[model samples]
Target: MSHIPYVPASTRYDEIPYRHCGTSGLQLPVIALGLWHNFGDDRPFQTQRDIVRRAFDRGIFHFDLANNYGPPAGSAEENFGRILAKDLAPFRHEIIISTKAGWNMWDGPHGFGGSRKYLLTSLDESLQRLGTDHVDIFYHHRPDPDTPVEESMLALHHAVTSGKALYAGISSYSAEATKEAAAIMRDLGTPLAIHQPSYSMLNRWIEEGTPSLLEAAQEEGMGVIGFSAMAQGMLTDKYLGGIPDDSRLASGKVNKDFFTDEALGHVRALNDIAAERGQSLAQMAVAWVLRDQGASLTTALIGASSTSQIDEAVGAAQNLTFTPAELAAIDEHAVDSGINQWWGVTASR
Candidate 1:
């Protein structure tokens, strides 16, 4: 049998600096690897294994997963669970593992949403799928209008209090909802640890009220991690030319009907700004999201299909410095296409 690629025991773990998530004491790599697309059932197991190994070698200590990330739903977790059983189990203590449950899972009402039953059951299934006793962070995937906010927070609070999760967070919640949830979680004594929201060069909706939300989180010693920091690869050079064959846009998972001529034109303009910054579109995009000068902004949740693509994205950390003039130029040219209206901060606006 071919030997597993030699993962050097002395792999430099200091390549990527660990930043605290929000105000919490838990530290994560500045860039975290997410298994949203590439860890599915259709993908090769070896390829996925390599990606996870490479990430750990490079000091990306955080791995983000969700219950419904795979095409068959729950497949990503199962696949990751296998990796954990074989390779990651030895290093589990050194890693920060996170998972979420907010979107639809099965056909019925019990399969999804942020209800107490769904949250509890989903976590159990996710734990089984991930083959882990406890996750570093468990998040409510999205806001649930049908359930009372207290119910959702209590479920998350229960996860931490019971030792199922070390910390808790809420993903894609409105600034108002985040405040309410944080207050309740604080009251429960578990306290919210982080807030995961979509923030990118193209999407600035979170900025509308995120500052205040962040301020409160800091007061409570929680952290904030931004996802969709690259706007689903829209801010990358991969789309500069007509949608390439290997790009995610070409993948059947992404609906092509939405990317009309207008969206393409907008992408072209944003690419020009990247060129001016002397950075790849993806690099510039990640840097844009990490612009919180003194405040403790934790990490960026980035997804990649291939090892090379992730390498390019992680290269963004090298050029985190941005001048005021560059920031202004980016704001002037980078405009959202209203594609993310469903995002909590922009849903009503």
Candidate 2:
């Protein structure tokens, strides 16, 4: 099938809210599109293209990806590259494209980790696959327990100074690591841009303050972006009644055991609050993340399986404010669902 000529919505910017990135002049939409799952080789290219188009039409300008974000790995960037070439190339300057280096990409020792070799080489590969001169934000995907933080941060500095990436970020780094990494970037004069972590109403780790990682970023003037804001469908309406036969949670990375009766009870309670707010449960979940941004978070990095899901998430900006009573009610049910797909992937290693 031939691709249709894309025309963006005229009211694109009306409902979306943009916030400053810490003290940096750079600003990002309250919600960012994360190509973590759907934009891969396994999915239809046109669907991927449509989702990107709809997201931009809804005022989302940030497209976040990592080097290894696909079933076969690296397919997300390659696929998005085609979409960019065919459709979004003309609007490149209007988008904030970011890709991370770290995580497994190629074989051998140099293919992964936070070392200078892996980070820089992987970024070049990401740029090649992204079909761009430079990404708006480049991140060292995670802390390298094996490599020194200074070494990893220096490569991020090199990425910015070399003009391959305009800004720098980190993901899944703990409070101590965030402070150390931010200091390294500050000393190098790159200055940390943002930090991505697995956060949602279900996980509640950020709220737990194991040490308050976002607090560290705030003091250092770096921004926060929360990923997995829906808890892999737990915080959404899908599991409120009970996991549907076709639910993604029925069989996926998330163990079925985590979706306990108690967890569903929480989801049901939350859904009632969302209904009272005149929004879907997923919208409420995303908005709750943005509500604490700048105060504790910056952007909610959302991943969607369908374009309508993106539309629903964008609609979240319509009603972000929560009453003290609503928040207190939320606190009543936002217990740890005991499932973190992110940690399930990384923590064991």
Candidate 3:
């Protein structure tokens, strides 16, 4: 309960493995908790607190958030701030908090995009809502087509240099844009630290296209964190029989068109592979993203609605290896399932 004094598990560090985030000295849990869903005001506050507490107990110190994560927008951050104030504030030094801007967060013209005014103001607001003076990483949520990439990178540079954010990150960026952004940040002396891309068994955009986003991040010496590793729960077993009444698809949170019969067929095949490997489909999906495929990702960002999901995701670190045969089998069914809605925005410029 929120009223009870909280104490983290002493064996928390021993529960999961940590990897260096790119070439940086900073290390992150192989699986980080994402507040993209279920942390909003629509969910019960107690349920939110339980999930956060369970994640930390499982050794997930990294918490990823964004400005427009809630149905009302900004409520996820506000709820997380309350959790931090009540339970996690004492362990702040052990936590890595990250938040992003660049998405539409307000109604006015200057409310969104990569403009310095918007990004800077959003960071200040995020800090306030997070109940902290700084975030470990501040990201430009996506590539702004109209705004020059230079302007966005400069805003992130300012975020780090001004001590409001210790690092800079970009999400859903094309490989070319990633290179350009990384160069600008490098020249600005900020050195872009991470790239968050949507990658999963069903959506492999980051690995498609020339050079691939994975290669670009590795080449630029930036860490890679793959969000939606479970493909908006498509890669999980929840939809195998059919969309559950309580599922995201049934709730209309995700595109109904994405779960075409062809895609579901591929999912079924992948689920078989996971079972053969003695893991759940969700666990396999997370591990697959963290697999040491030439350009190894630094971490897998998973959105969890309950403590069980957090446990399954963190358990992914226990077995990240895949035999050549396993990889070959997965290749047959890991084809893109038309679930990447962000591809248009990412590849726009």
Candidate 4:
């Protein structure tokens, strides 16, 4: 199929709201698009183009990526680069593109971790794959237990100071690590702009610990963008009738034990609450994470296989408020279900 000329909707910024990233002057869409799953080479390119275009049309200007997003690793960024060249190139100034390093991207000893070499080299490769001079936000991806926090943060400082990335971020760091990283970045004069973590109704690890990751980000004046806000699709209505033949759970990509009777029971109860609030379970989950529950998140990073999923996620911004009773009811079913894969990474520090 041949592609037509791209023209974004003139009313693109009419619906979704943008929130300031922490205390910074930069603002991001309350709901952003993440290419962690669907933008890989395995998926049809047309579908990826449609989803990304629809997200931009709906006012979601932030697009998230990483070095290892695709099944083959780096395919997501390459694919997204194609999309950028074909459709979004003209609107580059309006988009917020973020990519990360720190995960394994190559086989050699220097392929992974928070060391300056891997982080900077991976970022250069990311910029190449992204077809851009600089990303709006550059993240360290995760905490590296072996590398000194100073080394990792200094690399990020260099990323910004050298003009490869406009701002610096860290993902999956614990409360203590986040504070230390933020302090280092502050001392370096770059100042960590954001913290990305896995957060959903079922994976509430960010809400754990004495200071809690949320509180730490708040104190450091760093914005929060939560990934896996839908708990890898488990928080959606798809699992209500048991895993469908086409679902991620049925494909063995997600652990089968994650849908234990206990977890499903909680999901079903949460679904009822969503119904009462005139929202889908997925919408409720997104809203719950974006709500001002003590330490509010600036944005919720969402992945979508279809255009309608983008619509559903954007709808979350319509009802971000939760009464005390509604929050109480949700808390009952939102117990941790051992769904957070990054728990060990955050706890490693």
Candidate 5:
């Protein structure tokens, strides 16, 4: 295909739904785009552009990325930056772009943790790769066990104060850490804007403390947005007939051994219930994560490999409700995937 000029849909906002992220006055789309899987050097640039273009055309204006999101660290950000510069630059203010640090991006002592040096240096490199002056949300990807929590939080504060990020959020932080970090930010006068954790019916570690997390976030006015709602695509129908060649399981992102026989049985039962709900397994799975909006969840982060996947995932925003019986049906099979990276985390409820 030739390099085609992109023209975004004019009625895009009419296609998707948006909700407030915590209490910070930022309304994010019900479904946000994640650049974790694709948008790498391994993928074609035009295909990456098309997926992002399609997502924006459907009203998904929030794009999420982390510094180490590629097979080779930093490729995803480099690719997305190219797309942003070439295509979305004109509409930059209309979108909420978020990126994170605290992962293994480069070799050496200062490259992997939440020190001021690492966080600030990483954001600068990310901005250069993203081809932007600042991001909408800058996150600390995880808590550094060796670094003092105050130091990490301080680095995050600097991002906002220095104008490198409009707001600060944390990912994979426990409820206790969120409380402490929220307080640190509060004292600094830079209240947290959101929390990003991987959540799905299949991995509910975050669910264990959601009510309390939301309560605290509400009291402090912070919002929560969840990622991995599809469990790397296991929640979708593609695995019902055994893994396809192109599936994430085959690609090794989702562990094939994680879905044991027992897990498969639960998946099939859940798929049947999804069918009854008039949704694809993927749609119901995505919607299930957002169905508990009363908990103050701002959005569900979705990742797509193609334009068609983007179209299908957007359907999650359409039917966001469920009955008592439907909720009961889902619980019967919503077992923990055991592959959730944030499992075993506990916080006061």
Candidate 6:
């Protein structure tokens, strides 16, 4: 499958920096591409391919995916694989690819959960779909209470040892579960390299508890990469004007119930602050998440529905810095919009 020979860009936006994943030798860009939306079966292949190339051109080297990210589950990986086989194969080792396997993928028991059977088998299928022999990071998409913690950790350990994954991570787990998983991974000699958690202006639960749990991993040497950093575009001004036709809300992918009047008010206020700072609402929202005072993060996993959005998001890297006063203003104005309520608060398991 010969692609139209996209000559890779020689220079990327220098504003975006790469940080090491915990104590590991791998470094991920501050912003990463996520396939949670827009890379499904319904979208055109060339368009998605263009978006992927644009992301890489801007130094977004990590692309995150999950088994159930598409409307027809597995389609995201299948689509991504097409791009990989065409244009990305030449830069495989230069990029860091990641995928998860903890959500529902099939109809029966083997389809989902943290059991060794599910996780391992899912990885093989994921590898096939992504057109890769191994992923840079393999994550347990979620914790399974029905399956023992040790069992899940062992599966992750196997992924690294078998050379199917360079590092292992867990997502959407409670603070307690994170600590326990980290401990077992440590004892098994795998040493968790990272934890993928949902974090955004509207979701501060991880800031309260999960960070503390990650501290133990940090001590043991594991970095944290936040996912959904924009709260499904709710943090942006896309919904402030009553859901534009081009917005995700208009696509019916995200539920309309999240577009509350209160959320819109907060977005408008944040937009005003962003205007003062000479940044777009989306830029400010992303800059806010990545702007760490002392404990800076390794990367932010974000999604884009179009190539224009991808360019805008990559440009937001320039607005990463904020002053003490600006930070205070954001804290005062931003709402942990409950868009990530399930993972940020009660739903974490």
RMSD, every candidate, angstroms: 2.6, 2.7, 1.5, 1.5, 2.2, 2.3
Q: Which segments of model 5 are wrong by more than 4 Å?
A: 1-5, 209-211, 343-349
Task: Please provide TM-scores, in order, for all candidate models, with all chains considered together.
Answer: 0.92, 0.93, 0.97, 0.97, 0.95, 0.94
lDDT of 2: 0.84
286-348: candidate 3 lDDT, tens digit per residue: 999999889999999999999989988887889999999999999999999888877525423
Tens digits of per-residue lDDT, candidate 6, 249-283, equal 78887778777788777778878888999988888
lDDT of 4 at 3: 62
Per residue, candidate 4 scores C-alpha lDDT tens digits across 1-349 of 9867899999999879899999999999999999998888889999999999999999999999999989789999999999999999999999999999988999998899999999999999999999999999999998888888888999999999999999999999999889888888888899999999999999999888889999999999999999999999988999888778988787777888788899999999999999999999999999999998778999999999999999999898899999999999999999999887785254234
Q: After superposition on all CA atoms, how large is the RMSD of candidate 2?
A: 2.7
By lDDT, highest first, what's the ranking?
Answer: 4, 3, 5, 2, 6, 1
Ten contiguous residues minimizing lDDT sum, candidate 5: 340-349
lDDT of 1 by residue, 268-346 (tens): 7767877887888888888778776555468888987777766776677877888888877777766776656346631
lDDT against true structure, model 5: 0.86
> How many clashes does each candidate structure show, in the order listed?
5, 1, 0, 0, 2, 2
lDDT of 5 by residue, 229-342 (tens): 888787888888988997778878777777888888888999999999899989998888888646747888998989999999998778989999999989989988686766
TM-score quality measure for candidate 2: 0.93
Worst 10 residues of 6 by lDDT: 340-349
* Model 6 spans with C-alpha error above 4 angstroms: 1-3, 13-15, 210-217, 341-349
lDDT of each: 0.79, 0.84, 0.91, 0.92, 0.86, 0.82
Q: How far is candidate 1 from the true structure (C-alpha RMSD, Å)?
A: 2.6
How much is 273 displaced in model 5, in angstroms?
0.7
Clashing pairs in 1: 21-223, 22-223, 22-224, 23-222, 23-223
Worst 10 residues of 2 by lDDT: 340-349
In model 3, what are the clashing residue pairs, if there are any? none
